[model samples]
Every structure is written in structure tokens, then in C-alpha cells.
Target: MKKIIVSILLIFFIVGCGLKQTIKDTAQDLTNNTVALIDDAIDEITHESESWQATLQELSDNLTDEAQSTIRNEVQNLATRTIAAAGSEIRCNVDFLGARVVQALQRIKAELLNKPIPQRNPAICQVIPTAIDMNLTPNRRNKVDISGYDFDNQPLKLYLITNDNQRTDVTHAINRLSHYHLVLNLGSNGVLLNETSSRLVLEYKDSQMSSIAITQPVTPDCKEEEISFSPDIITYMPTHTRGDRDYGGHGPAITARVNIYVDNNTIKAKIYMRARETKSDWSTADGSGVFTIYTAPSKRRILTIVSDKETSTNYIDSGHAEDFFEKGSGELVKRFAFVGDTDGDEAGTRTRVKVTFNRVVVKLKEIGNCKE
Candidate 1:
């Protein structure tokens, strides 16, 4: 099970870092040939003009010039534009990978679920919300508590599989561990039935990820380390119009999922931020901000988000073009902080932009060696 989890991480990292060109080409050719074969078989059934028998006959015997020309034209069109993108589509295709991994995980998940293994992107990032550890002396209730952490605190529909894979959702649920009758159902006579090894598996319909993380390595100096976070998790504050002196912060107070990457030499983070624009659109997409790495530490410059169409871009050029990075502390401490100035008050005060890092997904203590 440990090896399987490790394999899943390696798979994503390799796919994310980009695969070798030769292997990519081979995979592309294989995928194309596979698709072509499936299409050829299904053509007779779908293309009502030809019967199955007639399709076979056409293959064996000579065909009319129009039919022959159709085949020739189809084969000629499979060039760079058609084949190059296929390999890239396959690399980031986690759904394809998860379908295969789910079969194996079903076998491992039946038993030994005392510890969770999906902390850092398992085949799927599952949050099986559990309650505090318990120890029963006598006359204790038999049940389990779970949370719908991934689905905005909704009731998580799942199966409670027994040691032998027997599952049921008929048990009673309350504010505490949902109670189930143990003695009435099992271990009759003088013996007591202990059903502690049961585990929860998500329903097939609810398997899609709520979001995705975009991670990148911090620097060449640091040993292989990266940060990740979903782009949609940022605060979406509507920007103040250009030349507007001062307006109330009448915007949606959304939180951003900021992922931190820390190593011996540096600490870097990736966050979802909205690009500054008069009217928000593709040009104001959060991803428009591009960071440029430099030789000196902390000298790395981050350009403001560029428009999706590349029509406009806000670059953090001047010393007062306005960007501030702060590390949090004390009782109400936050892991990281970033403030980027958009077109603030004409009075020279920086206005709060459309997005900010209100949530840090990873902590320095989790990585170790980073101090408070």
C-alpha cells in the first residue's frame, strides 16, 4: 500500500515535469492507432450507407473513386496539428489514472485504515473526516463519525465496509459518532463482536476532485521542492475603477488557498491572484502574474497578472510599484502573506486588489527545518 501511494506521487511529478520527447511521440502514435482502429470497426454500424457485409466487401474488393478518395483524404490529414496535442492531453489525465488505481485501492482499503495515506495527493485527495480517538471501557456505543470536508459541509454519502467488505448506511447518525447496534446483529451468545476495522469509501458518483493544485519548484539552489494550490481559491474583490479617488471595499470577501514550499535556502509560495484590469475578464485572469527568477535570493520579481489575450499586463516594476511579503506570527498567526498594489487611491495609498492569500495549505513545520 505504501509503495502504491508512492508510485502515484511519482507518476504525477513525472507527468507534471514533462516526459521525454521520444516516449511522448510513441504514446501519441499508439493512442492515434488505437483510436483509428476503433473508428474503423464502428463506421459500418454508424454510417448507415454501408452494411457490415458491404464494409467487409469494400475492404476486400476495389471501391469506387469517391470512397477511395475519402480514405486517402482522411489519412493525409493526420499531421503535427492532429497528433502533437494528444500526448499532452494524456499526461495530465488523472481520471484515466484514477480508474486504474481505484481497482487496486479497493483491495487495500478493506483493512488497516487506522492511518490515512492521502495527505499529499493520493490517487485522489480524499478527506475522510474522523472524530477524536476513543477508548471504550464497557457499555460503550458502536459507531463512526465522518465529515463532508470536500463538499462544503454537506452529508457525505459513503459506505461503511466491514472487515469482510460488508457495507451499510442504515446506521443511526447524530452530532456524535453515528451509532449502530453491535450485540443485536453479531457475536451472539457469550462473545462480543468487535467491528473496529471498518472503513469508508466515497461513492463513485462523487469521485471527481473539487479542485486542482498547480505546483512549481522554487529554485535551482534548493533541493527538489515545490509549492501548490488551486487557482479558484483566491478572494475575488472587485477592483476600484481607474482614477477613482477612494471607494468602500464593497467586494466579495473570498479566501485564497495558498500553498507553501520551504527548503534550507528559501521559502516560496504559489497563490491564485486576479490581474488588475478596468473590467475583469481573461486579461484579468489570476494566472496572468508571471514570476521571473533571479541570481540573488528574494530578488525574484513577479510581474502582475497579464490579460489572457495578452492585450494588457501590469508588471511590478518600480520599488513603489507596490508589493509586500510578510510572515505571520503570535496567536492569530497566518503562515504567509502577500500584498500587491493595484490602481489604489490617487492619494498614493495602495488599494486592496481583487485577490489575497487568506489560506495557506501547507505549513513550514510540515516540511521541517524552517523556523518560526
Candidate 2:
């Protein structure tokens, strides 16, 4: 029975993998809003069965007629085979199959969007390709680097989960070359310090989850800093834009607002970004993540911020920026920018986007002990 199940799964897995790549390639041609719409339609299908066909039609509108027909046929055929296989030894219903198929499709969609996925069973983990000969070591600048085969080729998220299940995002720390590698800058604000136990987690395509225990402690030079900013909310608008195409220019202007909270050595930011490609079309990028803020004068502030996976939309990726006190306003400000290669590099359709930060209202400021 297990063999049968595995065999059936293998068949579906192959199909799913192929379909995943095809859909992802197709998605590259779609605008961000269009892709979000398709994603919402898929989300709708998972919950309601009666209107799936109609929703599927909406999805098909963006795809080629041939591709749409092929997807429809594939779904029907896969459903039929699942039912046939179930009849021999088990029971299956359309509702169950519908839910499962939608879940699988959603997973694929998440991967394409470079978003994190919900936790599922370990069996599903087998299909995801993993790193080989991987070695992770602490490097200078309060960062860690993981190197090995197949390490940095695709979009992935990394985290440091403490024993109590607190997760810290460290995904923006990567070196993107012909052969990808990781350069994790775990800031010196002692955010990663004092964890009783922690492990580095990696989430890749299809939510392939892999983890390595942090057997060796990372005891960076410690320090405490007193920093407080007011208005609690800072609004960021695009200060400059350079790309083959302009984002949020077609309809609404793109904007990001961050609600910030400061603790001893860490900064908690709830970030919300409105990425509107057009007036009638828009999608949100929102999530909360922590930042390790190291004070100046040996307090190195490396602003690599990633959001919480569970609550953030996949579109709201990590922000790589700098945090500093504005010389004139004395406001604690964060400046960051991101790039969008709406089309591949060979096509030369790259957009280097920049956004502006508002003046910070500093209420309190202090520096704590710095240990070497």
C-alpha cells in the first residue's frame, strides 16, 4: 500500500514540478497586480468549490488559451486518476481532492512569488532540492555565511529560531553572483545573543524547510543603546525610480509606512507597503520583522530587515537599508531601496527603485556598554 501511494505521488510530483516551473515562467510576464489577482483566485478556489470554474476562468484570462486548456485538462486528469487510485483501496471525494489540489497549487504559487509557506508534513519535504556540502560559519561584521552546492541560486528565506520558537529573519544577507552564496550580517545590537538555543532555518521553493542547529554560540561584542523615535509611524515614498518600467506609476504611487517599536537591542518594525501598478489595480506588501541596531563608533548598524513569514505577504520582501541619525533633524531614520527585474537580465528590463524616509521624532537617546 505504501508503495502504491509513493508511486502515485511520484507521478503527481513530477507533474506538479513541471507545472510549477511553467507557471512561474509565465508569471514573470505578468504585472505584480495581475499575479496577486491570480493568487487571490487560487485562494478562493481552496475554500469554495461551486465557483472554482468561474474563478479558473478569471485565472485563464492572463494565460494563453493553449496553456489554459492544458491546465484545465491536467487538473481534470489528475482528479480522475486520484479517484481511480482511491477506489481500489481507499475512499476519496471531490471536496477532499479539490482542497488538496488547491493546497498544492498554492504552494507552487507561493514559491513563484518568493513567499513563505505554512508548515506541512515532512513527507512533502522530500521533493525539494537541498544544499549539499553546505558549511555555515560566523564571519566578520556580525554576519554568518553558508556556502556549498546549490546554496544561493533561487529565492529563499532564512531564519534564526530560538528554543522558545522566536524567529529572526536573516534572508537579505546573500551574495548574488554566478554561483550564489550567503553573507549573513547578524547586527551587533546583541539581537542574536543570549538565546538559550537556536537553529538556522532555510525555506526554499515549495516551502522546502531545512534547518541546522547553531551548535556553536555566536557571542558578538555586546552593547546596549538607548534609542527612541516618535510619530511611531514613518511614511516612505519613492524618492527616485530607475527601471525599464515604472511601478505604481500606472495607477497609484507606491508607498511604505512602518510602525516601529524599540527594545533593548532590537527594533521591531511592522511594515506596510502599497505597491500599486495602476489606479484600479494594487497589492499590499506587509509584515513585521526585527532589526539588530548597533550604535555608531564601533556600533555597526547593518540594516538588513526581513519580515515575519506567517503574517507578511510574499511580495513584501526584506529591506536592505541604513539606519542613522539625520545630522540636522536629529531624527533616527532608516533608508532602504529595492530593485525589481520585472524581466530577466538578458532582456535588460531592470528597475533600481529608491524611496524616501521622513524625519524621525526622537524622544530619547542613550548608549549602553560596549564590550570587546
lDDT of each: 0.30, 0.42
Clashes of 1: 5
Q: What are the per-residue Cα lDDT tens digits for candidate 2 across 1-372?
A: 976774565455547866554445443544354456557766787778545555655565544433333344454443444344334233334455455546645654564465785443321112111321113432332544443223424666767677789887767643443122344445554225343546667677537456655554444555434333232333332222233233333422334444444445345444544443443323222232333332223344423222211121213322223222221232233343444223322111232223233433223222333334
Alpha-carbon TM-score of each model against the true structure: 0.14, 0.21
| lDDT score at residue 20, model 1, on the 0-100 scale | 30
Give per-residue CA lDDT, model 1, range 226-335, as digits (tens): 23232332322334334333222222122233333333334333443442333222122233222211111342322222111111113332222334333332211132
> What local lDDT does model 2 show for residue 170?
63
* Clashes by residue pair, model 1: 283-307, 283-308, 288-305, 288-306, 289-305
Query: Clash totals for all models, in order?
Result: 5, 4
Best by TM-score: 2
Which ten-residue region of model 2 has the weakest summed lDDT? Answer: 124-133
